[model samples]
Target: MTRGDDYVLGRGLADSVRLDAQHLLWKMHKGYELHPLIPRTDNMKIAEIGTGTGIWLFDIARQLPSSVQLHGFDISDNQYPSKELWPKNVSLGLLNSLIDPPAHLVGQYDVVHLRMWVPNIRGNDTSALIQHVKSLLKPGGYIQWEDADLVHQYVKGPKAQEFERRINKIFDKAGLDFRWVSDIPDRLTEKGFLVLESESGRFELDSIQECTKTYLLVLREYINGFKKLPDLDIQQMAKEEEIALDQLYLQYSHGIVYNWSPVSLLGRRDD
Candidate 1:
């Protein structure tokens, strides 16, 4: 995979800082995300899927009491914080959730959490993935997953529209439909988990939203990564983005409507 695809925004300190900022936005919108979803986790074991940089897990780890354990797993540990730097209760592992997880990891965690992993996981195979996550949890354990609906991402004005169209093309080529994230609640039900309802909020990457610049940075990464793909037409995409860049300049300067809302669902495995 290209370096551009390494951390979805390049594995750099700048990307890490941007992610931290984005985390604040999510926290502000979604709170800690787990407290309301699950009943408790005082001495519970927790695992995070697709843990990039492991920043979110680290933050949650710090808040958690000493008895609790926080684990994060991903295909790449390139951006993970040094072990020496991690809290004693927090750990990072190199594991891909899409593949068959190791037998030893089965039924280990009291909570299995995944956030913002829509770009990588296939919509058609989400059910199987959730089932696997369920396996990682103890009886009646909680699964708190959060992801945004991108298939219906909205942008206003012709200028913003053009920018979104190009980005959408790249996502389409990648076969990414993060909207399936919204269906996790139902999927958990089908998998025999007790669906626990909760609240969520929308994220608008426009002139008004605070994280617009962060979203722009991510868009740039997509442009760079898609350019390297063998099948996608880089020339056409770049040309469209050229116009889009100018359009975005004007759109974000004034006011534009670009909405990307997220949902957080809770599921409990039957004992």
Candidate 2:
């Protein structure tokens, strides 16, 4: 992964766009209908794994009482918010969830959250991830996760279809089933979690006004991912990707591109 890829569509712009779109999706979700994604707490321990950009955790911290200790951990500091800029209630850490976490963090959180870690989660790691998450929660604590199955999402313009083929090929090779992660309840149950509740919801997007140029940013991500493959040579396609991305934005602006729903799941640690 070159430094250039993470900076695609400009440094932090892609991640920022993704964060904005996710906020709108969560607001529209049914579970969030009764309560906020992160319910109000007086003084509970909260953690978000693979918390990209830290925007969701930041917003949750901002709205919660300062007594609620909030923390976010990710593999890299590349997109993490500056410590000086993060809310006082929020603590940031560098740790890859794919690896064993430090012992001190075990069973320390009352509620743990994960979202959109698909890009990093491989097929075989699915079970191990559930066990690690279960290990992080206090007894009766909650574990919540949200993921989008892009395979079910959108396919509008030719460039969009092109992006789909390439991206889907990569995801397939990685053995990651991204679109149907709402089916995680079974996996959670297998890992000894009490399936408390789960909800699948779609984000309604009529135009680029709602999608916020997210598809382009995601396309750039996959293109960059493809470029990193040692056996693949996509230099020509990589250059064309920039041009195609502009076309995708035009399609989105004109309402030629539409959206599909993302699924969210919630579980409780029982053992």
Index of the highest-TM-score prediction: 1
lDDT of 1: 0.70
On residues 27-126, what C-alpha lDDT tens digit does candidate 2 reach at each position? 5554342235435559899888877677778777756779999888866667776689988888888766765568999989889888765555544347
Q: How close is candidate 1 to the true structure, as a TM-score?
A: 0.86
lDDT of 1 at 77: 79
Please give the CA lDDT of all the candidate structures: 0.70, 0.66
Per-residue accuracy of model 1 over 1-271 as CA lDDT, tens digit each: 1113343346577666766776776787665746564666578898988778887888877667888988898777777888899989888997767656799999999989887766566544586577678889999898887776666555667766767776777677665566666677777888888887644556643322655555666666666656666654764675568657655755664666655666777778985
What TM-score does prediction 2 earn?
0.82
RMSD of candidate 1 to true structure, Å: 3.3
